[model samples]
Target: MDALSRAGPRARRAAAAPGPGPSPLPWGRFAAWIDCVCVVTFDLELGQAMELVYPHDFRLTEKEKTSICYLSFPDSYSGGLGDTQFSFRLRQSGGPRTSPFQDDGRYNREAPLTLQREAAHYFGYVYFRQVKDSSMRRGYFQKSLVLVSRLPYVNLFQSLLQLIAPEYFDKLEPCLEAVCNEIDQWPPPVPGQTLNLPVMGVVIQVRIPSRVDKPGSSPVKQFNQENLLPAPLVLPSVHELDLFRCFQPVLIHIQMLWELMLLGEPMVVMAPSPTVSSEMVLALTSVLAPLRYCCDFRPYFTIHDSEFKEYTTRTQAPPNIVVGVTNPFFIKTLQHWPHILRVGELRMSGDLPKQVKVKKLAKLKTLDTKPGIYTSYKTFLHKDKSLIKRLLKGIQRKRPSEVQSALLRRHLLELTQSFIIPLEHYIASLMPLQRAITPWKNPPQIRPFCQEDFMKTLEHAGPQLTCVLKGDWLGLYRRFFKSPNFDGWFRQRHREMTHKLEALHLEAICEADIVAWMKDKSEVEIVDLVLKLREKLVRARCQHVPVREETLQRVGLYIDTIIGSLPEDLQAVLHHP
Candidate 1:
């Protein structure tokens, strides 16, 4: 038979995981095909074998090595006694066996066989089938085909290992074997059993000595000390970050890892989450820890943060491992944080790293803005200062003194004074970070978040004035058009859009600076400047969104022209100057 005919389908051992055999290869396959047993084998390459799962620490002892498998042979290898040019040989249980191809031409040729084995404490069992050739040919009687037991896909590696002699396997076909002196069982269950629990674990770093929170546990290195800076510190490896960027959202995969590694067995992880550099701690400790197996222990962070949470709920992960980060200190210093070192057992490193801390920046000065805020054209979006103050005061009334620390009191005061405080202020530190992204009535006072709302709220902002110039937009226009993530099968356009918007914001800030400089000037100068700026604003906004710059510019110029076409600013009865 040619090489193509020699290849066979994978074999799931009927002896170990016994189930009704697959119905005879549908109607297309004929009786003649079952006469020749061609055992197609896939031997596991050294590295590839690591992927096959086994109990933890299964290879600790040499005598404990019982069964090993490399190929999944189809059931067609049971018969076909033939006198071909070569003999059939294979490495099986106990030892190797070599025999000539049989030419019996009868007696059921194929034996839908699998190259799998079992073990107890010590002994191993393997099955090697070699049919003796009955053909009257003289020398052809001793030829054989050897089967290597392992997974398929070894074509490349096997070529490199050609120098290594191939072994012929033989089946033990043992009797009721019993363990004696930790070495007797010939055929029994493997060393480990499947687990049925949660798989949340920690990769200990800086192993918090048992002495922590005690007299002299030892202090972790802090950056505050001037003279102690060490050699160039590498960026905290974001190895786990890839998990958050996978197809499965990071959180779901994390919970799944808990289920697979810590839960029941005879199962496998088919889909993992996409990975993200920012979510490293969450990926390893919480996401992939449960997927670890003693037989095949490979740790990978494939889950993406964007999709991870779609699969999890309250009970999916441990309640203690909050998915969100609410710590104000952590939020303020997000960029400076190093690799997230798992602080506790729960995968809650989304907050801050172990050594890093958020230091509150002292307020330089608070600008009093009662009159400007109340009278601003965009006054509608601004909350009533009195109402905000009253609400915060009410919250403060019942809280413990500690909860209302000086910092908290100051922040609450800012809220009361009609200032939009960041939503992070309201959240508890232990809570997840996702809450900040959620929509709420009070609304988060985050920077670009507020700006996003302000732009959309035309009526509330009351004739919002904008000053933009083509020159103000340098890299922004180039970036938006250069982005390839939009049309070519985009998986995450939302994030891209956000990035584009942020680029545009810098343009707004530059425009604001130019307009701020001309706030006070000659009427005619201001009017022309306003017209030009309005033209730019309209153009910029229309370029990105649906609105047109021509239309808004025309409207702004018409309004300003009409107003400029009016008398002077009738000051409060010309306050005696």
Candidate 2:
């Protein structure tokens, strides 16, 4: 049966468009947080199908519908009957990818290019369940409740699904409507602040750490939370996204993984289930903390994905993107990928979780090889035996998993910082002297960053000189320079430096006597000067440049006063807005 026809009347009514009359409460305001709620189920004939999507008008393309269905039901059922939850990310099919600062020529279009570029993707949190029954076809019933959103609140969204999905499977229509209404009341996801989001009577407390803050540090505040069940003081981590838990199994080979991630190498993670597969892929992207991972990645990839043909073709080299897959079929299909990490299922039989063994393979095997990290890539940094010994000792003592995760996370964070600190020092040195900058001509261009020159600095000042962990630092830097992450980092710094120069020039102009400068000039020249100053003001407001608001305000007053003194026709042209 077609999905809509199979849905009950209540389901249809809840999702239907508003009838022609008084307009319904605006949903577009909340669209930034939650896009739509959807119900997907397995079809006897059509395979995975989208049965219902709330706000029926929030449409999905055919390709999107198929992808969502496949991702929502990540694993094919054999005879199981249990509920599983996970999250995945996909390219946003519909939405404005424009900058949040976009307005009617008020903000500079080129200021927030990174934010606009990154807005092209969105996230999905899924709660899937299955039950066995002789009365149903195939002896089972299976379905999934999914929340499609742009924010990456893994802990918050998964908790929301846990509260709603079970009730949804039991009561159906009422549960869907209730959840949709609750979501409609949620506030916009403003970063850098703690937000108490209520869904289906549960207040989920979380904070999406701001990029402006220091990595790994987000302040916590007590809230008078009320719910059917007591909520956590704060989610264990709304910032880290449970990255440490995902990397726990493969903790031993983390340095090797970090190297590969930094170099933006094409790797495939093969896991026993979609939950593990997706988490592993997402965690890999954040290994180079504080520096963004610019390469593309798919948390859960299947043979049915739209890019399957492009990702699997042997005719060309694999794209520089991380691909996570659950099917053994990918073992043979993606065998040509440079790096492959095969993760084993969770082993809960022991008091303490045993670290999975890692083995490097000479040839890629379709089914015979065991679970381990399989790659020929050599690691430049030496393994930290001291840290490994402590971890192993903690395992021997049967330390709690939470303690183990924290220990690992701290070590990785320090390792990344050690690598980044030296670069920051060198980049700071490249900045030109403030005295050399003049108000007359454009500020002199900053010196170009050099790889060899940077390498030469290692003898006197490098990560190894300060950090306890040692490595062939030169070798690592060489590989890093060739990666997409390096390109992104360099470009961001270049933009910052360029903006700094512009800001200095602006400050100089603001301090000068603008009225005296334009005293002898014609009306046309005065109008041109005002326009240039206004453009600079807009750019300063839009970009994260070092410029005081007082300077900008003074420049604005100068423009207004200068325009007031002009002839009537010219003044009207200046004040057209």
Candidate 3:
């Protein structure tokens, strides 16, 4: 099949941009959410393969194609098979130096520069379908329909796929064309605003929360009370931050999981399907939200992934990453990983799924173990059984899914914030007093973090103080200091504090009477001071040290004024630039 040459110009143009920029197609709108639509089929000769990329002419590097193929289909996908849906991420190596989506005016356009520098990843939503086919060699036809996007709106994408995939599987290319055309009509994602996305005759209303908005504050559109509609308007439950759905079965061990996430411990999640594996991984990564996870994570990993060897190697300690896989091979391959959570298929038992009990295994027994958490790390904090009980009771009372999800979200958010509060307070104390600053000398360095001293303060100000949940937070903090997560958090806080001090120093220098200082020095000395000030300004701008705009302009005016008063040769040398 000539897959590459089948698409027309519009399809090619829509999927062209790798990151976030305007599509060349004459659709006078930003490339909304869907980046590209792909159809991956299992080929008898080539194994997992891409049957067609909707934008057939859109070029994918061989490496990219390999990644898409493996991630789209589950490995060791045998036994009882039905349709399954999951998500994956792909890290692109390069993009525009500046924010590419600035013109798009989306709230999430400003991606973190540091994370972007490391590797800017995008999301892939895959719907895998298998059907009995006697004509096929494998006795089944297995394929996946994928939608790529820079945004991580899992629910919206999944909903889109529900409408598109089944039709596309039956009708083929023509269905994809109709879907893409429908997507073209979608309004650009505005932060904190409800979006009514109409796709294939269905209006899916959703709110994409802004980073500034508190978690779970996203409002749902309301239907008029006077209109006695035959059917009730029900908003889809948001799963983007749905930690409850993933952890409900294993809620008793969530404290330990939170600690592991905080320490950036390497873990492997084994599940029965790609959907469960991906959801669990995504949920675990967000266990310590508000404080970035600062480590690598893959939702649905496969044996054929590029980093498969890097992740599975037993030569040394495992890298800080959370790998989710369905293939039984990982059970043995990732046995050496510090923590492993093996979960069974998600069961619908009303309020919660069947609680997956934590088994304190003498050894991982990687060769054989039931579906449960297998980890040696003892949890420092006590489990808040009251919270779980309340949730269960609410479920028993038949609370709506939205209500249950909100309750879970609030509990977790508070839990995370309570843990982080003491750290924030202590870090604030480390900053140097403003009175200690001197115009003639350098800014004072921040006091180093003392673990023992900070631990002592926890008695009064720890998470237990403000939060209903109680724990041996002191022990958690002591262990935390030795973790990569603490180091990353400390370094980030330290750098930000250091930047503030430097900005203060620059302001002090700018405010000093440079004109008077020049009076006391020889011509050469005056020239040297002028040059140093200029260099400092350039350095501050380049480093993004957050100096005030007015301060920068004032320094520039001073430099020009000082240089004008210098000897003609000195003035010419300074003005040459």
User: Candidate 2 — what's its lDDT?
Assistant: 0.74
Per-candidate TM-score against the hidden true structure: 0.15, 0.86, 0.81
* Stronger candidate by TM-score (1 vs 2): 2
TM-score of 3: 0.81
Q: lDDT values of the candidates? A: 0.24, 0.74, 0.74
Off by over 4 Å in 2: 1-25, 94-118, 225-233, 239-244, 347-361, 519-527, 542-548, 564-577
Quick one: ranking by lDDT, best first? 3, 2, 1
Q: Once model 2 is optimally superposed onto the true structure by TM-score, how far is the C-alpha of residue 49 displaced, in angstroms?
A: 0.7
The RMSD of every model to the true structure, in order and in angstroms, is: 31.3, 6.0, 5.7
* lDDT by residue for model 3 (1-577), tens: 3654577645654554233455445443324565567889999999888888755545466777789999999778765567889998876533523322233332433332111212267678999999898999989989999987666677778877888898888999987877776666566666655666566666666665555555546455544434423333234532354666677778767778888998888989998888899999988887676677777788888988888889888898999888889988887788878788999876656545677766664555655567888777878788888878877887678776657667776777788788888999999999989778765566898998998888888878888777876667777777878887888888988987888887887888777887677776788877776777788788778666768988888888888888878889878888885
Candidate 2's TM-score: 0.86
User: By the lDDT metric, which is better: model 1 or model 3?
Assistant: 3
Q: Residue 495: error of model 3 in Å? A: 3.2
lDDT of 3: 0.74
